[model samples]
Target: MSIQKEDIDHLLNLDKIKADEKNAHIVIDPDQCAACQAKPCLIVCPALLYTLDETGALNFDYAGCLECGTCRTICPHLKKWEYPRHTFGIYYRQG
Candidate 1:
């Protein structure tokens, strides 16, 4: 899949707005993430939403998330971690 420059810019702008909105956010369980030695969420996130901190814990940015389910699939250590609420994640203009 290829994205045009304009589309990329738009997505970036949207992400900024999404992040700024406090109501819509990524909810993560640090305890659930802490024991994850594999840290698959760090690599599987297409938008790099799942980032690591100085302590090696997962930090997430819901706005930049594409909601592709990659993190959900790659994470073998956790049972469930909630993402942005419905209708609060990325929205592509085109399929």
Candidate 2:
């Protein structure tokens, strides 16, 4: 079956993310990130949470994370990785 943009959008809309305000499940080492030339996290994150600021510094928002562990697997600069606390993080609406 051919997947249209509308079909993808509809699938995305079915997922819900509830962020943990006080806790972030993923942590990247700035020192490591600064030294790294190839920042794969920028492209590998399905949630599109990773970005580079004007100063070329890496920035990430834990909110709306898909909890997919893509960053942890792809990022060598990652300092810490864990699941969010109970009752926080993504809630899949799809069956």
Candidate 3:
């Protein structure tokens, strides 16, 4: 069985998790990212942050993140993925 958008949306609706939206701890260098053909971050991100515009520019919103390092793990262009320095950045409700 497949988990539909509504299923994921329902899960998100149930989340009592808090996030620090001001500071986007995970930073991506656009220059380094430009060369990448396969952008796994857009697909792997649970929060639906990484996106592409009509002009093909990378649009990322690191708000309400799970901080699971899914983006970091998937990006081949990444030399080193940096997690949030602050401890209170991501608060997981269920997990």
Best by TM-score: 2
Candidate 3 lDDT, 5-48, residue by residue in tens: 57766777755544556555777778877777788877788777
Query: In model 3, what is the error at residue 32, expressed in angstroms?
Result: 1.7
Report per-prediction Cα RMSD to one decimal.
5.3, 3.9, 3.1
Lowest summed lDDT window (length 10), candidate 2? 2-11
Better of 1 and 2 by lDDT: 2
Query: Candidate 1: deviation at residue 39, Å?
Result: 0.5
Ranking by TM-score: 2, 3, 1
For model 2, which pairs clash?
Answer: none
**Candidate 3, which segments miss by more than 4 Å at Cα?**
1-9, 16-18, 78-80, 85-87
Off by over 4 Å in 2: 1-11
- As for lDDT, the candidate ahead, 1 or 3, is 3
Clashes of 3: 0
- Where does candidate 1 stray beyond 4 Å? 1-26, 76-87
Task: Decide which is better by TM-score, 1 or 3.
Answer: 3
Scored by lDDT, the top model is: 2
Query: Model 1, residue 23: what's the lDDT?
Result: 59
What are the per-residue Cα lDDT tens digits for candidate 2 across 1-95? 75554664567698877888888888889899888899898888766677899999988888868889988888766878899999998888865
TM-score of 1: 0.59
Per-residue lDDT value at 33 in model 3: 73
Q: Per the 3 Å backbone cut-off, how many clashing residue pairs does candidate 2 have?
A: 0
